[model samples]
Target: MSEIVAVDAEPLDLPLSEPFEIALGTRREASNVLVTVETADGTRGHGEGSPLPPVTGETRTAALETVRAATELLEGEPVEEYRRLTALVRDAFPGMVSATFALETAVLDTYCREREIPLSALFGGPPTTVETDLTVPILPPAEAGERAATAVERGYNRLKLKLGTDVSTDVERVAAVLDAVPNVGLKIDANQGWTPKETVRFADRLADENVRLELIEQPVPASDVTGLADVTRRVDVPIAADEAVFAPQDAVRIVHENAADIINVKPSKSGLLGAADIVSIARGADLELMIGCMLESAVGIHASAHLVAGSGAFRYVDLDGNRLLASDVVPTDDGPGHEIGGPGHGVTPDR
Candidate 1:
């Protein structure tokens, strides 16, 4: 008989020092869902998903509802069948992709555990570790530079600088960071702050500085495909689609329209299956892919890390959610998060 599985979700409030304000929305803290799935064989798997403001309008209450709905669906079905069910019901609830992803994660974890294999192994494991970049949120130029220096000191070789504040201040922040950490490769995330004209001007300045930025993410508004395409044509640096590319179709469309040179993939925004499809679409379009995450806990971060490790398409990755968290959910018996070696996501939160 097929194993019956159950799932659960809880709302978590982890605070950030300051509210992280972007063009999409403001986040005072990260509200996440902790998902667990179990089988009759007495095996259990776990996952977490951080509902981002851009995808869900920062609706924590709605996110909780979405997860609750997902739980009801998982109560009796075979754990592996979740992806199909999720797709069937997702269109009816357009704003709950993050929640859908949380549920999907639990099922994937259960499937991986049942097979006694790591998630990376299921996707073709990587021989080497996946390296990731550190992110610096928007702050005063001097403070931002210090943060960048700290990241460099911590052995990070790449940095993603959050922009979307004053363009002048943003420029100064970039310069300060580069000055402090000269060897760190830099990427700017405008978070849909600039208009097409402003994006062009900003890109020109970044180029003139000869910083040779890795890419510019979401320089224009999220909904303006034409504007994004226009900016892509004018910018010297590669353009990466973040907020603008949430779905596989979005990735395909952006690539087909030449709106971006790279696509940022986040597992929480796109369910595990959707994220895989997005990566495949990017490869088909010959666009580079980066795996990213919101401020999540070890469970979500580890799951994303395992996915990136298995997918060679990820040229840039951001899996630092564990570091951002004030507390960890990984069991005391689990040792360091990196050591959770098993099938599924290897994520069983202590909670």
Candidate 2:
């Protein structure tokens, strides 16, 4: 309701509790940019961007620079001109998705907070609590199994195992984890590490071993839509497209090719508005939806959780990015494993 006063962007190197390993590589910390928007009325909103080089092809330096540029575009504008500001940022940095997400989130958060409404309400859905799956990063089979068991003990029923090495080793990893927790729901993410042949072989072997899987995510590279479709047809388990679908067009293409049974929506990949478009496309195509997070702090995770809780469209949530952090920017109860409290995303940042 007031004029925008100032915008600030800063880079953060949030340490991870453990090294996060996937098919692409390992990360010991998250490289994120935190953005804050302040209005003339003294109301402020917070946002965060965690750039995954393998996914968004953005480095920390790029995210910081993009946010700085966005700040310049947004300052001196009316607080209500959020759409215009975000559009300008997107146009200026076409591929800087994470930076755009940070700017959009900060502006929207400020608007919602000033209005005393939850962010979910803006999305036209009542806020609802959702459960999240804990990820078991790639490690030795035995070590991976131990981590899975520990997570199950900590009240998590769903476990997402990182795979995509070779077929035999991947099978061993899955088998070991199953041995550790036989009844836990299993979701495997290959992170575009496997080929069509390897995906099929892995699926067939899992069936032979009587390993029931909840889903398999991104078995093939993002560019290989037809190859993903081939794997989807060959496997009994549901296939979710993560890297394969970043925008509405990508979702449409995947649906047209029957490449995947589900689509993963990450706000950082497409910004909040773009994520909404992707969700619309997925719903129109009768595909299931998932809300995932890049390795972000509570600032970003809280924003994403609000979107997921409000839409009520997602069947799966992987918002444990905060759990992997050694410290959080906001006070939250056990990562996103439970509902956050307060207005907006129920978050109050310490700084």
Model 1 bad stretches (over 4 Å): 17-28, 89-92, 126-128, 331-340
Residues 1-351, model 1: lDDT tens digits: 246456667786677645565556666778887766677777777767677666545466787787777666567777667567668546656757667777777777788788777877755774235567877888888988998898787778888888986787888988999889888899888888889888888877877888779988888878998899998898888888888877888888898899998898988777677888998898888889888888787777777877777776788887766665556776422121244356677667765
| Local distance difference test, each candidate | 0.76, 0.86
In candidate 1, the residue pairs with backbone N, CA or C atoms under 3 Å apart (3 or more residues apart, or in different chains) clash, namely: 117-343
TM-score per model over all chains: 0.92, 0.97
Best by lDDT: 2
Compose the digit string of candidate 2's lDDT tens values, residues 4-96: 789888887889989999999999999888888899999898888888888999988998888887766788888777777777888899888
* lDDT of residue 330 for candidate 1: 61
TM-score of 1: 0.92
Kindly report which residue stretches of model 2 are placed more than 4 angstroms away from their true locations once superposed.
none
Which 10 consecutive positions of candidate 2 have the poorest summed lDDT?
A: 333-342
Best by TM-score: 2
